[model samples]
Target: MNGENAYLATLMELFGRANFETRRPRTPEAFRLDPIRRLLEGWGNPHRRYAVVHIAGTKGKGSTAAMAEAILRAAGYRTGLYTSPHLHTMRERIRIGGELISPSTVVELFGRLRPAIEADPDLTVFDILTAMGFLAFAEAGVEIAVVEVGLGGRLDSTNVVSPAVCLITALSMDHTEILGPTLAHIAFEKAGILKPGVPAVTAPQTEEAMAVLRQVATERGVPLWTLEGWRYGPEEVAPSGQRGKIQAPDGASWSIRLPLLGRHQWENAALAVAAAIRLREQGWIIPDEAVREGLERVRWPGRFEILREEPPLVLDGAHNDASAARLAETAAEVFPGRRWGVIFGVSADKDPMAILAPLRPLVERIWLTRSRHPRAADPQRLAEAAQALGLPGRIRSEVAYALEEALAEDIPVLVTGSLFVVAEAREAWAAWGRMPMPEVDPIPVRVGGR
Candidate 1:
């Protein structure tokens, strides 16, 4: 195979293994960390070599992790960031100093990991990717890594780390099949990252979720910090970004500007600020200015991302009802009085009505579509679902084709539902506008284990 093909083949080999991200676990027991733990043991546990900030939540966890990594990086600390469900490339899951892990490095790391991978027939694709992230961080001499839990906290592969700080963003009902049926059950799973004596900070949560987290923290002897005394509010919200201010517990306040939009992101920023303060208390040398700069300059694409200006095109990865609600609110707030032509798609496992209901009032018409993801819901099914919700839409099998049709409308356009859909829309926009592509076309979406 040629060099590009070689890299693609290597990635395919890894994705061909059991993957829970593309497929739901059969039961909660199916998510055990034993295989990953044993696999890491064989590699000498590179994750233990660096300090970590572990975060888990139904929403905003990725944004919180990205903000924390940016803050640490701005403080001159070599940082590694590991997130999940990559928008474009598998390499986006692992980053050092805000750069994606190169394809060659992924190939090299997979080659190094192959022997152990072969020995353990039970390892999932996420398990292998988690191993690659830890090994890459160790190899790159990362001082601290911000790790976002791929799924629930307790059995997640990333939970292997004993983090310097744990952060749980605002919790809501999500992954009800895997985590549980209620908010408290979901909170219990998210609180699984809480280690004894490891201080954790949380965003504002429902009383049910907060109570569970407190019980878990008290049982684990983890000192948990809530955003009780902290204060934050958005000063301005615009298409480009938003300006916000936060008043931390210690009475120190910061005026911040964030590239990521939405009122929820302001909350995520406050949570990051709280986590950074906890890190400072641990003597990490993060200054006030670093926090501000990191919060301001942090680049988390695909979350309320404005991909174009005139006749606005917004892209967001709001798959769940709570996040979709936020996306709807933000979209309406930012582009007031403009009826939107929305291109919507989502995973089969998600509730389409719960997602579409939030956007109904804001939407004039929908271009129902499916991403290339194996788990993506059928567009024809989505069209029928949208009809039930009193919304009108036509079906499109491809995201680019859907976008082409949606943009032809004179109103604002929104491409959302799943990160996978947004990723495809992003690439289509880039291609149509002759913008630079990534090192490779997004890793092939024909993944297995579904």
Candidate 2:
């Protein structure tokens, strides 16, 4: 093997030791901030060195975090963005100034934390990566960092940050086994990120979720902002992007264009705008122009990403019922009545039927498959679920085979269910073209991001 491949494999081996993303824990106690806190403390508390905007929710948190970081970067701040479950490389989880973290830096950071990481039996891969992100950001002199919660906020490794602003995207039923079975229970976990006196922002939510959030914020004495006074004007959706106007609570409004598709993104953009406004209120120098420019330039791949035309090939990481519904809505709106063949796979923990149910009407056929992720659901199980839903398709053992079969329909094709499936299909398409498609960086790449 080449030196680069060997180095990448070494990194993978290091991360594989305690990766909960691949092997989920059965209990809630498996997630906590104490081990991460101790590691950060020993590293001189690097996460506290920079200002932070902590985000949490069932959906849209990654996009919201991306939007907020892009805005901050446009304002000329040395910004760090830390997100979870990347589409391609592990480096995509940590970025400085919109650039993926270098493999050498990851190695160096891991080396420094290895002693502490080895000593703690409770430490997961996320805990180590979170510490590395903090250290990397501090070492790079980052002025601000946008941190997305990896899982439920209360006990998540990323929840240790005392953020300047807290943002919650749309909430729904997800990670139910660990977080809880109800929306209120999930909201309580999400609301755990709220710090005393920190301003919090949220998208429109059901009464159940909103009540829990309000109660937690009230108890913590944190000011909360909702979309009650915010308004999104009519949006023009196109294959390239979408444009709409947002009216703030203060009677101020502005037109904004997002390169991201779906009406759901409009809601995420509104939350991001509110976050920027909250930051400005905290004496940040972000101007309105920065907000506009930042959001327009933000690029989050594998979410409604169109990989090809002719017979359009779209990729989306819609793992939950709510996000799956949004994906179906966007597909109908953007490509309307186009014959669609969906390639679907998901994590073993997810309810595949709930995800596939939304697309049943639009999809002419379904290609059931599994990504290479250890946690990916069995193709046989997925095929059974699809059959029960009255969606017809055969099972492909691998995502690439599913993509091949789906594309042969000469119709619009969607690869969805999990980010891992999307990543595999994307790479498969790129391989067929005799070209490389790396999500963030080209130097070092691997399969699983989560």
Candidate 3:
């Protein structure tokens, strides 16, 4: 194989050998920066060499981080973006300036770091990947690195950075087992990223979550800026899911346009813009035009993404209640008085009722299918769960079969409930359309585990 293919194969060989989720998962020992710190120490602490923006939240974190990266990139900064649980390729998790690190790069990094990784077999896959991102960004000489918290912020591998400005996106309850059972507990986990005197930009959150965040910020003496305080409401909501004349933190406002659908995204864009502006205040020097250009140019796939135009195949990875509610609300606003078919699947750990309860009213028919991932809830079980909610749906074992059935009706199909499900559907769609879904080895874990 060539360099790229060789690198890809090497990554597959490395991660494919270990169980990603269950291997050394849920070790919440108090925020030890040692794993990354040690790896960085071995690699000469590359993460410290670059300025960073650390983002942590229950929801909208990825989108907000992507927006921040886009804004920084638009402003002519050599940027590195690291997000988690990629929808398509593993390379999607680590990128420098919109280009994914080559497979050869991954192979080379793994080879270089193998001695360290092998010495400590206790480290999770995420920790090693986090190291790779830092090393890659450092080697590439990126000016700024936008890091998204992989799991709960307290013990997540990505929390090692002392960001220039920390951003907490809209908070909600999802990772109850690892983060916490209550919103406050979860908020505390998200707030773990706050450092002494670092300014934080956040979107409007629940009174409970906000209270905890405020308490944390107060104790740390870190300034907290709320997106709600940033003014300007929607001047017009177009049928095409576009908004006009959004107000900024400054007295001057601009007509904001986002390619992504949903009003929640408008809030997310506002948060990104607010965070970018705050970064500028901290000596980044990003222009207003760059902010506008970034917002317009931002592309977060699998979040209210419209894949096919003719029949309107919409894909959203709203795996939990808050995201599902947002998806339902956005659908109602974007396609008012219209019903769409839904191809749904979610992880076994997720509260299926919480997700489907709000969505059932809007969907014409539900095609339940299990994602190819091991953690995916069985389609039959999901269908039963929906039925318990009085929203009956058909079950299919395979994703492609369900997609075909949903598409046969010629109505708009909304594929959602889990990011893994969305990714699988996208892969199937790509295969069906004769497009290449970059070849990666199947994670060694069984479909439903051993």
lDDT of 2 by residue, 172-226 (tens): 9999889998999999999999999999999999999999999999999999999
lDDT of 2: 0.87
How are the candidates ranked when ordered by lDDT, highest leading? 1, 2, 3
**Which candidate achieves the best lDDT against the true structure?**
1
Please tell me which model should have the higher lDDT, number 2 or number 3. 2
- Clash number for every model? 0, 0, 1
Q: What is the lDDT of residue 307 in candidate 1?
A: 74
* TM-score pick, better of 1 and 2: 1
Report lDDT per candidate: 0.88, 0.87, 0.80
Candidate 1 lDDT by residue in tens digits, 174-280: 78898899999999999999999999999999989999999999999999999998888788988888887999777899998888889888889889988888888
lDDT of 3 by residue, 57-151 (tens): 87788898898899999999999999987876677889999888877788888989989988876566778889999999999989999999987
Model 3 spans > 4 angstroms off: 1-5, 16-27, 30-32, 232-241, 434-450
After superposition, the stretches of candidate 2 with alpha carbons farther than 4 Å from their true spots are 1-6, 434-436, 439-450
TM match of model 3 to true structure: 0.93
Query: Number of clashes in model 2?
Result: 0
User: Candidate 2 versus the native: TM-score?
Assistant: 0.96
